[model samples]
Target: MFAGDSDLSLTSIDLFCGAGGLTLGLENAGFLSVMGLDTNRDAMATYRKAFPDAEAVEGSIAGYDFGQWRGVDLVAGGPPCQPFSNGGKRLAAKDNRDMIPEFARAVNTIMPRAFIMENVAGLLAPRNREYMAEILSLFSDRYTILPPRLINAADYGVPQKRMRIVLIGLLKGSIDFPAPTHLPGRYVTSGSVLRRGETQGYSNPSKIVYARRPDLRPSPYAGQLFNGGGRAINLDLPAPTILASAGGNKTHFIDELHAVIPYHKHLWDGGKPRSGELEGGRRITILESAMLQTFPTEMEFAGSRSSQYTQIGNAVPPRLAEVIGASVARALN
Candidate 1:
C-alpha cells in the first residue's frame, strides 16, 4: 500500500472506484488504497494510471469477493446511483443498478471499522424514505450511522455547487460531519475557470464550429441555466452542478453582458457577445470539469473524452473527500 510520513496504518478498498477520486482524496488525507474496483474498463484503466501502487480490478460488485478485503481499515465507495439521480428514472431501490444492498453486504463481510458511501441527494427524497430507512437499518445495529448529510462541493473549495449525500458509519462511535470550510460568496467562480486557458481539446475544429454558430436557438433539451429561461451560472461565484451528460446545449456559460454562450466558443467568454462577430458558447472542457471536482490540475486522465467526462462528473470531489478522510483519521486515531 502507498505509505506516507503520517504513517497511517489503515488501508481501504474502493468499490465502484471511478477514476480514483475518493481514493486520491483519502490518500491525501492519509488512508492508503489497497484496491479499487469498478466495471468500467476505461475508468478502471484511468484509476490504475493514477494510482500505480494500488490494484484496480474490473467486475460487477455483486459477483466480486469481499473476502480479500476483510480486516481492512475502511471500505469506501459511491455505488452506481442512476436509480437515485434526479436526471434519471427515480426507481429508487427497484432500479437493477441500485447497489446499496451489495454495498451493505460488502461492509458486513469486510467488517471494516468504517465506511463512507456517497450518492445523489435525490435518494433521500420523501418518496424514497422507506428505501433509505431499509438501507440505514442494515448498519444501524453494529455501526453508529451518522445522519446522511447533504454535502455541497462548493462549500469545500470546489468550483461547482454539486451536492451529494454522504453516509459515514463507524463500527463503534460516531463521526462528526466536517464543517463547511468555505462560505458562500467566497467560492471559486466559473469566470476564474474560464480564464485558465489550459484545457486540452479546447480548440478542436468541431467544437469551434458549434460554439460559433449564431443561429442556434434555445430548446427544452438545454439545461435550464443555458436555455435562457432558468438561472444562468453566477459567473462571479461557484458554478451550478456540472453534469455527466454535459454537451452541446445542456449547459452554457453566461457572460457579464447577459448573453447566453454555448459550449462551442472560440474565446472563453464568446468574445463580448457582439452580433456578426465570432460568438462564444463552447462547452466547458474536460479539464475544467475536473477542476470543478477539485482534481489537481496536473492529474492525468487516461480515457476517451466522453469517458473522462463521465469519470470526472461522477466523482466525489477530492476536496470534500479529503475533509471526510481527515475526520475519519481523527476519529480512528
Candidate 2:
C-alpha cells in the first residue's frame, strides 16, 4: 500500500509504539507502517501479534540509529507521559524518564515529510510551559509547526473523555485538525459499550469487586477528574480518562446501585458502598478499558491482566488516532 513517497501513499514508522494503537490508526488512514519500536517486551509481544507484517523492534530509542528511516514519509508516536502527568510527579525535564528529547532527535534525524506527537494535556499546563516552548522550538526551522491542540477523545466518537495534546508538524504546509464528530451531550457513554458480555473472538472479562478499607476515606475523584461525582460511574456520560495507575485512586464504575445513602456512608462503613463494593462498582477490566479507549473488540491483545491494563491505558484511542491520522494524511496530499 505504501508504494511511493507521494503524499497520498506514505511509508511510516511508530516509535514507542506500545501495543500498536498509534500504528493501527495510521494504518487505517492509509500510511503503511514500515516498523514499530518499544522497550517493553510484553507490549511488543502484543504489537507483534497484532501487526505481524510491521517489523517490531524491542529496545530503547536512545543510541538507536535513525538513518535506516531516512526516506520514511512520516514518524509518529507519543513520548512517555509519566514525567508530565498530573497523576505523576510532574517532574518535567528533570525526570530521567522524559523522552521528549529522543522524540525530537528522531524527527530531526528522520526528517520525515510529516510527523505527529501526542501527549497528556498536563505537558501544556502552565507549570511546564517552558518545556513546551522548548519542544516546539526544536522544529521551528524546518517544519511548519501547527498550534499544539488539546483534543478530547469523546469529541471524535471515542467512548471516554480523554483530553490529550497533539502537535502536528509538516515540512511545507499546514493542516487543520479534524472537527468534532459528535456533540457534548450526545457523546457515547461507558455503559453503551461495557454493558454487553463477551462475544466470539473476544476474551471474556470478569468483573472486579472493590474492597473498602476501613482506615481510608473514599476518593473524592471516584469519577473522571473533570467531573466531581462519587466513584459510581454516571453510566449516562462518557467515562473519565482511563488512568495508567495501578493504585487505589484509579477511577471505578458502579456495577450495581445500593439504596441511596449519605455521601460519606462508605467512609465510615469501612469501605462499604465504595466503588466496586457492590456488584456494579469495581475496577474496569482490561477489555473494558480497551473498549473505552476505542480499540476494536476483535483485536487481540497479549499480556497479563495488569500488564494489558497498562498497555490499554497508555494507548492513543484508535478513534482519536484515526481522526488525527486522517488530518495528517490530508496535509501530505
The alpha-carbon root-mean-square deviation between model 2 and the true structure, to one decimal in Å, is 4.6
Which candidate should be chosen as best, given lDDT against the real structure?
Answer: 2
List model 2 lDDT by residue over 1-333, tens digit each.
333646456788999999988998898888888899999999999999888988899999999999878878889999999999887899999999998899889999889989899999999999999989998987647898888998888999888888999998998787787789888999988778766333223332334443443223454334222112224455677877777653233535444443223434545454444454234344456667788888887767777766777788889988888888888888887
lDDT of 1 at 111: 87
> What's the C-alpha lDDT at position 125 in model 1?
89
> All candidates' lDDT scores?
0.74, 0.76
Error of 2 at 307 (Å): 0.4
Candidate 1's TM-score: 0.83
Steric collisions counted per model? 12, 7
- Candidate 1: stretches off by over 4 Å: 1-7, 196-201, 204-232, 251-258, 261-278
Query: Please, what is the TM-score per model?
Result: 0.83, 0.84
Candidate 2, number of clashes: 7
